[model samples]
Target: MSLSGKEGGCDCGAVRFRIEAEPVVVNCCHCRQCQRQTGTAFAVNILVKPDAITVLQGDPAPHEHPTPSGAGQTNFRCSDCGTSVWSIYHAAGDGLRFVRAGALDDPHAVTPQVHIHTTDKVDWVAIPDDMPSYEGFYPGREIPAIMGEDNAKRFARAVGRG
Candidate 1:
């Protein structure tokens, strides 16, 4: 699962990223924010170490939002494209970094291990086969792919542990 040289970019190609290692916590998020931001039912996010994830092009900015849980989560975005390339969450004194899953050049390399925020998930959306489910958010992807620690804390916080 070591990505080593995998690369991905934003929709307009204004922003690009390089993953030096395999992602740890890659999953499809069905939260309302994800649906609104991606303009789709869900968003795929790849969690990797900040050190492992390198933005190859223009620097992205963090768009901060107060989640329903009240913890602060920052979506790292491309200033020009306004694409939420990544997100960082700081909660309980922890940090996690999450990359937009679809942003990867080879998205097939990773798959979501579970579904979260089922309560807010759209009624028409159906869960996948064999993937685990959580009524809310899982504390830590607790796997290799949940990249930036800051982002994980934010995710956990967003799920109400912040």
Candidate 2:
């Protein structure tokens, strides 16, 4: 979906942000870590460049958390309500950020292009056949096709991909 003027904030409105560009891709991660962190069946993340998001309000606190892979991620959360607004994985460093889809003003503006860690997905969850589902992470080579070509290129550049 187009993200020309997409905006969102914490539940308490302490922190607000705007997405300057279209997201590189959306993911529905069923990893156990994501489940425990979100306290849900899964988490939907919009992958985008860190600089692409413009903060229009208060600053959110960044907390370092460990993933199942042992690598870490820093979750930026609202200082007031403590809601997770976004996260930056160590693998991507500061170049990429995973914006919480539920934190968006219009959460439906973006949808998952792929479902990862499906093996750990809830038994009641049903995945659409139109979208690819992987027991683990999918290959980066196919990301360009899943996401728009323009967004994919921008993501590659941000993550230092050739």
Candidate 3:
């Protein structure tokens, strides 16, 4: 699916943004931290290059949260509604942003390409049998197989790995 030009915002419509390019990958993370932070079973994130996202309206506030790696992640959220819009993980540096999928105008416009941190997933939440799932983080070297050559290259270049 071409996510280019896709638009989304915070719950209160305070922060609006657009996706200028297709996403590198989509992930449904079931980590305990994600569950606690989102107050849900999981978090569906759209992984894209930082340049791909263009904020069109109100500025979202950045809040840092601790990560297992201890480097932490910063979540940009709507100040008015306190809705998380996107996040920058320290490990990934500033190259990428993980946009909250549920914040999109049409949440269904994209689908999870992979499931991660499944070891901590809620028992009631069932991932499709055919879906690519992992007990922890997805292997970075294998991203090309899942994202295809072009996107894998894009991702690599974005993270300074290419």
Best by TM-score: 3
Q: Which ten residues in a row have the lowest lDDT in candidate 3?
A: 140-149
Q: In angstroms, how far off is 4's CA in candidate 1?
A: 3.8
Candidate 1 to truth, TM: 0.78
Error of 3 at 47 (Å): 0.8
Instruction: Kindly provide the TM-score of model 2 when superposed on the true structure, using C-alpha atoms.
Output: 0.93
CA RMSD of each candidate after superposition: 5.2, 1.4, 1.0
lDDT score for candidate 3 against the true structure: 0.91
Model 2 over residues 53-109: C-alpha lDDT tens digits?
Answer: 999999989999987667799999999999899999887657888999889899988
lDDT score at residue 67, model 3, on the 0-100 scale: 96
What is the C-alpha lDDT profile of model 3 across 7-67, one tens digit per residue?
9999899999999988999999999988987889999999998889999999999999999
Best by lDDT: 3
Alpha carbon RMSD to native, model 1: 5.2
The TM-score that candidate 3 achieves is 0.96
lDDT of every predicted structure (CA atoms): 0.71, 0.87, 0.91
- Order the candidates by TM-score, highest first — what do you get? 3, 2, 1
Runs in model 2 deviating more than 4 A are none
